[model samples]
Target: MNPPNDPRTAADDDAALRALYGRAQAQISAGTTARLHRARHAATTGSTASPARRSWAWPAAAGFAALFALAIGMQSLAPPAPPTATPAPVLAEADGAAALDDGVADALATYEESPDFYLWLAANESTLLAME
Candidate 1:
């Protein structure tokens, strides 16, 4: 015959459930124990690393640094343009000769003011001509 419906079975079931709950709580308190093995296994297989990681990272980094330096130097080192060509000399020799002749004409006007001055000047003109 089926055993009598005992209330003790219900108490046993309650005890079992409490034991399972305590174990789960303890595992949780121990801080994520179940995922650690899987994480380590993934690292061992290189699954945790990026698949498309470049192998020439160092050279590429150096090249980029060199390019950055080159760009900065180019920005700072712009050369100044040369001065433009100037126009040719405007005053000729005949203009200078005309200026000297105009000065001599003014001196001859002063020379005509006295007759004794003219006689003395005429005597000294030979000495001046010899010096010249």
Candidate 2:
């Protein structure tokens, strides 16, 4: 290995690398060289896309823009949708014993069905109070 601080060694190394690169470059096939040249030219000229492909870009962009505009226009021109109708809340009757709402009637029916639970609680009331 060349010394890191030696300028002569660095120069010699650079020259050797350049010579190696040149020989390898010279060994490349003509077809490969032509392809490399074309690639370099295309990169430098900034024309990687074919003319046919590039031709469709503007039209495609315009078509998308037109579609977006049509969608927005249709949304604006169309009538506003009618507000959704919700069921009116059940109100209590003026008289105390009149017809009850379905929810209240169902709760009353459930309590009536579970009379055994109420009876058990009544029997255990004194014992539960004593334990507490």
Candidate 3:
């Protein structure tokens, strides 16, 4: 192996690489070599499709563009859909207020009947707050 500061020139390195490449190429089978040559030739020649074969693409593209424009035009010309008439919500404001009042009254009656339960809840709430 050469040292970090080897004195080899670029030309020497390129020559060595070429020699290695030549040896590798010699090892490739003839069939593989022929396939590689055919691939390279086809790439260089570009697409082999005849003009007649290629001509259909333009008409197909134009047809697709016309369909897109027609769709847009029809959408713009059509009348806007009428707004849907949704039935009003079943619960009215007054009904909701009455229900809330009833719930509050029931809760007050329960508290009045079970003051001890409320006290226990309050005591437990203080202990829970301290834990937090």
- Top-TM-score structure, candidate number: 2
Candidate 2: how large is its RMSD? Answer: 11.6
Model 3 lDDT tens row, 1-132? 656555576668889999999999999999999988877887798845355888899999999999999999999999999999997767687799899999999998988899798899999999999999
Model 3 residue 117 lDDT? 85
* lDDT of candidate 2 over 1-132, digit per residue (tens): 767999999898899999999999999999999999998999999987367868888999999999999999999999999999987655543344344466689888888899887998888997899999
RMSD (CA, angstroms), candidate 1: 30.1
Error of 1 at 43 (Å): 3.6
Q: Which residue pairs clash in candidate 3?
A: none
Candidate 1: which pairs clash? Answer: none
Tens digits of per-residue lDDT, candidate 1, 21-83, equal 988878673346657666788889878545467667988999999999999999889886799
List candidate 3 segments past 4 Å from native.
1-23, 39-64, 86-132
- Positional deviation of 2 in candidate 3, in angstroms? 7.7
Cand. 3 Cα-lDDT: 0.89
In candidate 1 the C-alpha lDDT for residue 99 amounts to 90
Stronger candidate by lDDT (1 vs 2): 2
What C-alpha lDDT do the candidate models reach, one value each?
A: 0.81, 0.86, 0.89
TM-score of each: 0.24, 0.47, 0.36
